[model samples]
Target: MLFRVALATGLALFITQIKLDFFESYLYDMRVRLTPVPTTSGNIQIIEVTPETVEYFKGIPKAEHHKKLMEWLIPLAPRAIVYDINFDEILGSEKNKKEFARVMESFHQLFVLTNFLEMRGEEGKLKLSEPYEKIKLFSGPKSSDTANFAKDGVTRRMMINYQDQVMLHPFLASQINTEIVDKFKIKGLFDFLETDQVYIRFRPTGTYAKIPFHEAYKGLISTQAFKDKIVLIGHNLELSEKDYLMTPYSRSSIAMTTTEMHANMFDTLILNNAISKAPQFVNTLITILISIVTVYIVFALSPAMGLFIIILLFISYLLISYFLFWPFGIWISMAHPLLAIFLCYYFFIPYRLIIENRRSWEYYQKNKLLRQVEELKTNFISMMSHDLKTPIARIKGMTDVIINDGFTVSPIQREALDTIRSSSDDLLKFINSILNYAKIESQGVELHLQSKDPNNLLTDVIRKHEFLAKVKKISIETEFEPLFPIKIDPELMKQVFSNLIENAIKYSPEETIIKVISKEIDGMVVVRISDSGLGIPAQELPNLFMKFYRSANAKSSPIKGSGLGLYLAKYFTELHGGRIFVESVYGQGTDFVVELPQN
Candidate 1:
């Protein structure tokens, strides 16, 4: 069990480190769906560079179009104007650059997106894709780099910094809100990006207010709409596939635009609500704990119970994870914990059961060998008992001849001979008891069923035991009902009754009465033999019919007998479709009851 738990924990850790994307992606998407929709900050607005606007500037150069758009936006006195479009190449018009630079210089803060492009001639060199030199003169020292994507090619995190010639260029979102960045002491771009990468808390799509570039340029939207607003100018229309990026909110049927993604990043930075990955050690601990608990439950409980517990734990863990992401903004790894549970349930549990089953089979085989040895011992004792009975019978016959065949002997010799004869008779009775018990144990009772009156059978049994009863001065009384004639093995029934009566006589004090009662009830024959002798001890009554099992009280008595009589009696009675039980008190007498099917 320990090994399996360790194996599962180690396996979960390894899988978590490697991060199988197929599973993790699904989990991440689930967390995204669970996140509450973000409220729109009304301070931020998007001005989409639509296809209509692109077509409107068909006759004009792209730089000229930007110049015209900026010319219109500059009069609004916006707090900041952010351009999501990149200007990598130089527009070959000095006149357009001067005009754009003049319009950009009029604004209080103007930020243009830049990207770090790999230089073609250099193996490991990066250069900034900047706007025109005249345009850059007015844009200020920091240009936001627009290069941030997860390993899965999704834009979930923003590149807070980019390295160019040993210099750091902060991300656009960070540059827009330098106070938040400095306040949080955010450092190390990718570390901060990956570890503190915020899940985009998105408002419903199409909810962020947008104005068409042509509408803005044509003076259709009033300047009041842009007053005191942070204007983000970018293409909202699907100009090409490269213009779009996948996000957590991206579904199978829809993808979020890069402009909307920027808005989300901007809003996240403003709110300071970036979701972060839980620490590696914490995740590992959670995975290991889950693995160990799953293994323990599977081994400790029954299969059905174990399955129920596993499912409950799984659902509870999921709920916890959902709560953490939805409310607390923490994205702990769910893949590994879920995998650990899966392997423990689907793999480890079945393996343990197989091992247990093998052990059980081995145990059964060992017990079978022991039972065979016991059977051999029983058979040997039975054969020896049969052989001794004959010799004892011959001894009795010789003793009888010597004592009774016209021989005169002293009283002492006659008494000695009688004692020897009586001892031999007792020995023969013990041997017969052993043989009868062994016969039932080694083989089985074979009954010869005959229709017999219950009263007549009881009478015969009582007559057989009358001498023994008289020796003890015990009265044997009978109460018989008009029992219907039933089929039974007469010899076995006689033995059963004789054993009960003899036991009663042996245990009872002088003049104690032993009562035998027979009756019919509910289509069954019932016979009850109750004795006022020393009743069986309450603790010993349960095992009273087991072979050779003598009670504590019986062991201290002077009664001379093997303990096989009652065992054989119960065996024979049950073979004829009957049940036997004894009810007794510690000092009171016992009542042995036998019931048989009437058929």
Candidate 2:
């Protein structure tokens, strides 16, 4: 336990201190390699303007060819059209340019793809600047500012916004979403925080709608359907290299193509569900930590207790993950962490149980039957001691009164009687504590459940403890609310509260305050008793209510206690179907709360 604690603390500190970006990158690559991602992009018909298509159409007249393409596009209404080809040169005649412009105007959904070029000259550089929708920069501002390419100087990603009446990007489909929004009158932003990839609904599967560019001019395929569909005018132009990017659909040459990128973006805008970047490192660390903590607990705890703790931890993990992921569409994988816990338990638990059994056997062999006999003797003595305690206390009190007030005695005799009385009181307390433990073991304490007001019960308990608090020079404050009555045994519950308060008083320093508050929460009555005293160690918390279990810090304290008080209190509370719990930070004092269901 100590080693694991130290290791976790030291490693956390070390990880914080180190800059391991390169190493992390390597790990990330390795992890990605370990997990295979298969590409499932369906085939899309490519209308390539290759040398063959150009030759077949006679000669490649750029303007005339574009006109012919548009004619073909006007009929085959594709899901979208991307004009990947650049019109930067304006090489054709002014009349031809106007004709091409008219063709562009005729069709509305065509995504005319272009680039956001970044050129750096010694003093000045001259370049035409244009904004288009879906044609904007692909990158963020920081990357755009300092990014100058070595090859044909161009910015891969652009920073621009798209609104109707203005094209924002150099991409083909950037205009589609804005146009749709304008047409549909849809308002507000769609958040794609968790999901990454968007799924496009339909595209022509085979070569029915697609034909060679030259063939289009030759009336090889019908151009009837493209009248209203998006048309992309881009080339398999060798001079122009497409922007390569990763989309959930495809990641190869297709992603690089200008038309496809527009299609991908458009699909995402429409679908609104894209695969998001899950926090891999964060989830991984959390899972592993939880597993490790579970492992430690399993190893350190007794079987029954360990099983209970495991159940609790599992429930906590489920609730946390459910709240964190399901409602918000976040995906944190529970498989690995839960698997680690199960795997560790699968191997470690049997090994632990075996070792524990062997140790128990060895101890049994050493003591033979003596240990059993001694235990039985101690139990008997404890029971007898407890049975005689109340009467003995009464007799001692009467004797003290008689010796002090009624009879004249020597100083030595009086001192002896005082010592006897003190000893008798100590013995009586020990006996009562043991008797409580025995009663719990035998299920001798029966609860009489009734509609008990929590506030009134707290008040009564506080009243009984006020004199004790005064003796310790402590202030006891009670804050009670109008609470619903809960089913509980008043006598047993009073003992529970009294034991807890006594312990609080015993541990608290003089001039300190012990505050008790009772309130109702979600069909349950909660009583909280907070004290200004040294807190229990975090490690000791799990064992706090266990029989004969005393914390190291508590044992070292000057305050004397039987430790059975809390154990008995817990037992009695459980008899009434209630729970007691504590929250504390070392040196920051503690808060003990008891809850009973209002049923």
Candidate 3:
């Protein structure tokens, strides 16, 4: 059990640690979109560069655009102006550079974007895309990049510093109030603060005020309108070849630009709604719990009940993870934890089967004594049958010879010989039944199948019982539709027919009718022998074919019967790949049906 528990838990953690929670992270994005915090518009705003504005400055220098924007906004004394666009290359003439640098130095709160180049390994000096000399000198290498795309290429998280490169939103936030970003400095999945990350709680689109640069440059808002609010400037969707990332608010072909992403990150940090992955220990505990619980359920319950509860367990865990994690700004492992539960249930099936099979073996061992007693009974029946058949056969033979030799005898003596012959025949039938039963017990029934006409078999059985029917003053009626040949054991099928017809004659009253019918029904050969005489009670019908079982009516009647005939008939009929059934109403009538597959 411990080994299985360890295996399940280890597999779960392996999937989780490999960051294979793609589906889980997708749900996290869904959660962010569903339950967004209130818009934080009062503290932040955006200035966008649209296609028209980019066209407006097509032939002009990039420095001229930055210079005009700085000259316009410096008078308002905004909290900070962080650029989300890359200004990595020097452009324009030297006069243009010096002019932009002078305007940029006037606003001490201005911060420009820095781009980081990724290397093969983690340890190194931060490789930066060198911005235009003037912007770097004024903004002091501002890394205003808050994008952290997960495995599915969606920006759902933000890191304070990634691979020795500081991010933008928190950088500006720390400058505004060091304590604002300090509260979110919690340890991440591996207790590594060097690359700590948290989920960004985004707001709906239009949550921030954005103005095209043409409008902002041409008096979009009053000069006093920008006081104390942090401003972000970057590309708008109207621009071709623009930088964009997928956010919770993004859909296909509609993504947020770098400016909007920064706005959301800034708000998430200040509002303190940053979600973190649940602690590793909590995740570990949950994985172990699901594994052990599913294993226990499989071991303790029946397979069907175990399957039902396992399904319920899966749904319940999902609900719990959604509610607990979404509201609390933490995400528990969903994909792999569910995988753990399923693995435990699925892999433990064979183990449970082996245990059940062992238990069945133990039960069979305990019943050894009962099986031995049954063997002894079959042996005794066989011995008695061998000893009794000789005398009965001799008596039947002697009586037949004397009766057929034409010896003259008195009427009383002749009648006595006839009685002896009849008694011997009954004894011979009883002995044969016992011997057949013993043979069946020692070795199972094996059929010597042959294709025979069912109609012929039925007529032969009726003729053999004609004398008894005549003696009881019962009329035998036949209605045989032409039947197809069926594969069956001839002798065994004949025995079945004789047992039913003889029972019909023995139980019937004088002047009753016995109907024997054979026909093809539903592509199979069917035979029914019905008697209008002492019918079986409904309560005893279920056990009528049991070995040596007699009904109450039979016990009270004067009929000489051993009660094994119908049992043998049923056994033989089924061995021929056919079925026998009895239908009777108490004190009314009885009917026997035999159906065999026909070729």
Candidate 4:
């Protein structure tokens, strides 16, 4: 088990680091997309430069237009304002410049966003675009707002430390402030951050209150909603992909604008919820443990129990991983561990089936050997019984000769000779029963079907057993209805009937009458022979006709029986297309019923 676990774990973790990282990131994105941390994006607000504002201002508005917009927001008492728009040219009039300066100084910290496009010219020379001299005139730090999207083209991280300092890069403005982690230190972020870490956790779009730039300037803005709030201003023209980018929450191919992307990052930082990825070693260890545990239970337990446990373990792992990702912001290895579990199930179930099959094969082999031994024992009994029949017949013939040829010396000698003859007859009958059973067991009994009178045949069988019944002081009663002359093997049916009558007489009490009835019904011949005798127990009824199986009473009593009588009776009756069964109540009475198909 240990070896298999090790091998499977090795194979599963053998995936290249690149492949593993990709899948791990994919799974993380899925968790974020499905069960994002429930947060109220109540604090964030965006003021977009919509197409209506552009049309109102006639083409994209100029810097003086932004200055006018900020003038309207100053009375709202915003904590800070972010301008995602660029000022690449000098203001046309000094009047416009002074108003822009005043708007910038009105807020405690106004972040003016900048864009840097690094491209190669035709001569392979670097082309850098510098902001207009007017942009430098504004106060406060003007950081580049270019965000770094991941390799998969997903914009998941909003802030990364630069020159050992965590700087607010892009865009953000807030209306509410609670437990904000926006001021988290750079050194602390570096201690846990990875190059591939996803720090941006965005709530659903439309969580923030957004208004058009023109609407805020036209007395449509409310001071109560913006008071002491952070205000962000950006362009959100319809059909504009110039600033649009993909966020973690972006579905299909629909990407959110870069302005919205930055807004989500600021919202996440403020909430102090920066989800972190566990180290690579952490995933490796988890893979090893998951593989080992799966192998231990599946390989060591029964198939049913193993399968049940695996399902439960799989479900538990999924729930744990999800909860850890959410609210806890801990990313563990899901695909790696789950793949290991799948591999275990794929191989272990068939291995268990093979084990069960081997056990079944062993059982089959043992039963076959037992059957062969039983056959050998029956063959020995048949051989010995056949040998005894000749000797018993000779003994009976010699005793008869001595008594009939006047060879008896006296009354005591005559009685002794008679006893010898009777004992020889009894021995011959026992031996014959064994030989008959052996013959039938080998399927050697051939039926000789003849249309014999059913009543006559039954009467002959009962008459043959009359002497035995007389000896036991049991009377034989016959009720024979006029029956059809059905095709039958007379000799075989006679023995079948004879066996029933003899058993009745042997087990019945003195002065009890055994009734033998024969009749025709439903194109069939039915015979019922019943006696007030030692009845068979109900539990023993099913095995009554099994070869060498005797009733409990018969086995315990001194009554002479080979236990093959009823078995032979059933076989002979079936050979003639008939069936025989017995019904009995313990210690009360027993009845034997026979049914033969009539044509």
Candidate 5:
């Protein structure tokens, strides 16, 4: 999980570092469009230099017309006048230069635009283009120019400082009042961008109060409109694309005029509004956190729920970004965090599915092989038990016949015949145990259930084990507590009791006591068979009832028997909804307990 988050975060940060222009521009423009335009303060106004005004002054030089307009505005006493036009060339006669300089100097507050074009010299070093000598001399310290736009030719940000010198908008703002100038000195005027530039918090396009230059020149616009207003004079005519620039508000078919762009900058300064990009580390942290959460949610829920959560998260992130951009003027990179979430979920879910499917297939194949092996084992045990049962029974019968025949025989022959019969009986008992175990395991055993007295059932099992107990000289004792009748498979119950008693007689020393007890307790019947015997070891007791399991002590002892007795006993008892348990201590004694539901 950590690896997935790290990979996703790395990929997101890499993409953000690349700063793809189109993607970034799209997001930035969308944010601009969605933001509500703020109410205008109407303190700044534009006087457009339209084509009609240029045509009106065609016979005369453009500089002379600018001089005449300045003459008309000198009496209005405007707060300040900013020229967005570039007067960077030697124009007109010497008389025109002196008259323009004189009129420009007369204004108490004035700023002029100076174009500084960066060009490579012969040595490939950048050089700044110089402004016209007359314009530079007249504008003095108030000279400033527009900043460079992005590579996409869209003006999303404004330059605050270039080459350690203040740019136009901030320089103009500093000249407004001592307080604003102090703010400029302390906070500096622009919010930082990826390239250390600042974004322009643009109002809606053409939002400022605008008037045609022809109208203002003809005295159609009243002087009061210019009073106390910072007036901007620039060309808005559709002469060429030279004065037109793309902005966040620019559409495929429309672009804003450079005059309007400068006016927007001026308005931003007045309102003290700036948009700043969030720190890179902040964006990276958000990306990583969202990526980890996406991975966890996808794994923890169903695919549909995960997708829903992703959509919800996307919307929530958009809201957060919008709030930051709108009210707080903070711009954070949204693409990376959203993309991190998408890629983490998309890649991880399928990878996990493929892994789980492969494991399931392996388990299926293993189970198939195990089933085949179990069937073969059941068939082999069934056939071997059947084939051995008949021969062992016949051996016992022939030995019995010989011993009973009327004939004279030596004492050694008589003892040999008796030994043969006993050996045959033990072999037959072992074969029967194997057959019964296999039948039960193969689901071939059918129960003949009836309501039978627990005492009678246990007594029958004891009677069957009497001969073996007598041979070992072990005394069998019984304690009964009037057990209620229980519904059970009689033969299966008898087999359970027979195995317990036989094991007690086999493991006990001669003359030891084997006690059988039955009682009703807690709505259940419990039977306990205990013996003074060489008890099972503590470590081997857990596996004692497992199929074909024998303790080390039992394997080395002289007593001979198959190990299926206790395993089959446990199986048959459970089949009748009963439980079996054992308590033992090494070298002391052992007790086997069976509990059956009374019903």
Candidate 6:
């Protein structure tokens, strides 16, 4: 147990560490894969960059498009307007870049684009040019990248950190924040500084509300203004190639574009408690708990059952992580924890099987010996019974003759003779049962293969047992369905039915009903003989057909029976390629069913 526990703990820890560093990234990817975007606070708003606007000034003059965006911003007097476009370098006429920059300045609500880089520097570096000094930048901790390196030196879980400083307000953030501050006529960032940042929570992936950019631009939205809110600049169009990411969540496309990558980073900021670090001890404890649980389950269950449990547990873990982790800022490493659980299970199984092997072997050997002893006793009983049959029959015949021929005996002497004759007949029948049981073991009797009508056979058996029923003051009832004749050995079949009916009559109470029914059930001929008798116990049912095995009820009864009737009946029933079974309840009655296949 200790060994299994230790192994489980180790596997869980290894998995947990991997999750903290990398698997969490996959979770983030999954979140993004659920289509993400930002909505303005409280109201519906539009930022239109339409084809018509592009055509309005003859092929979307760059200066004119910027001016139109300015126009839209001023009229709406919106909370904030974010320009997704960036102007890092002058691509068109340098004058046009300057003009666009001046228009952004005029709006005062608009924030323009600037880039920042974080990189390692040479120890004794030459002075950089002025062109490199204009970009906005902020510094924080040197990015710590963690990944796995294989023997071939290939890295998995890529984390790139090429800058010593990051852009605090990337182009979109600058634009949106600028618009909000200008429209409200109040400084931004200061109020947000003293207050806890409100995280923008969203429903999970596959559940986000998608509003088309065209519809928003066309004034079809519920609300038409954002008086005091931050607006996000992103795409909803399919043709736009600006969105893509390579994370596990980005399964739909080949890859995510650079703009989408930035969008995800911004989402991380909005949902500020994005990354979490669970204490090492907590992770370790959880690992241990899961391992121990899995090991215990595996040891307790059968292999098939254990596998089923493991599958359920694995699914449960995924579900818990799916629902719980993101909400609590808890990032559980799904793969590693499960791996640990299974590893523990695997280790425990072999150990458990090995430990139980000796106990199992002892049990098997004891049962085998008990079975052999039972067989020997059955054989002995059968042999002795056969040996006694001839003498008992002879004695019965001679006594009958002496009584019938009027040997000049007194009345009392005649009565005694009659009693002796009856006892001899009973003894003879008992011996015949033993002989039949022994005969079942011998492969001597050739089954007379013939197609026998089951309905006729059922009727005959019921008729023959009617006398025994009469003696008990029991009524025998029958119901037979016309069925196709089934191939069987008639003589063996008769012996089978005789024993069953006799046992029923011998065991049943007086003045009760014995029902015999025959029907075609599932392409087989089924004969059910039921009697209202002192029934067998539930626990003894499995051993009912064992040779010389009688139920507890039978053993305690006054009825003169050899306990070989059902045993012999079972053998003969099987000999004709049929099955026999009994259903009984204590203090109720017993029903014996003989099912013979159609073929």
lDDT of each structure?
0.72, 0.58, 0.75, 0.70, 0.75, 0.58
Model 5 CA lDDT for position 240: 61
Rank order by TM-score, top first? 1, 4, 3, 5, 6, 2
Q: List candidate 5 segments past 4 Å from native.
A: 2-16, 54-61, 88-97, 117-150, 175-196, 251-254, 370-599
Q: What TM-score should be assigned to candidate 3? A: 0.60
User: Of models 1 and 4, which has the larger TM-score?
Assistant: 1
Better of 2 and 4 by lDDT: 4
Q: Worst lDDT window (10 residues) for model 4? A: 136-145
Pairs clashing within candidate 5: none
Q: Ten consecutive residues with minimal summed lDDT in candidate 2?
A: 137-146
Clashes (backbone N, CA, C under 3 Å), per candidate, total 0, 50, 1, 3, 0, 10
For candidate 4, lDDT tens digit of each residue in 183-237? 4331114232322123666666666668987888776877776765566777777
| Model 1 regions more than 4 Å off | 1-19, 38-42, 50-77, 86-101, 117-151, 163-179, 183-204, 207-228, 251-254, 294-316, 341-365, 396-426
Model 1, position 262, has a per-residue lDDT of: 65
- What are the per-residue Cα lDDT tens digits for candidate 1 across 108-178? 57766544433335523332333344333111122122342224555455544222221111243455556
Error of 5 at 360 (Å): 2.8
**Alpha-carbon TM-score of each model against the true structure:** 0.79, 0.37, 0.60, 0.70, 0.57, 0.54
lDDT of 6 by residue, 368-486 (tens): 99878867876887778877877888888889889888689989988899889879978887877766765656544567878989777767877877876897899988888888888
Give the C-alpha lDDT of model 6.
0.58
Question: Model 3 over residues 40-129: C-alpha lDDT tens digits?
Answer: 746787888777776777732276667777888888889988777656443666677678777866777777664453333743444323
For model 2, state the Cα shift of residue 519 in Å.
Answer: 0.7
TM-score head-to-head 4 vs 5, winner = 4
Query: What tens-digit string does per-residue lDDT give for candidate 2 at 1-599?
Result: 66554554444434334443333323322233333332322222346565676566555446756766666566666655555555564356666666766675565555444444233332112222232222322311111111232122211222223221223231223344444334222212222222112212212122123445676656676554344444434344444444333322332333344444443334433433222224557655765586568668778888889889888887787566555432343445455555555655665677677978999999888798886676686679666876697688787988788686869888898888877886776677667778767666555667788887878877888887787789889999888889867778888788789888878898888899999988888877888999998888898899999887778977888766677878988888777677999898989898999988887
The true-versus-predicted C-alpha distance at residue 111 of model 6, in Å, is 15
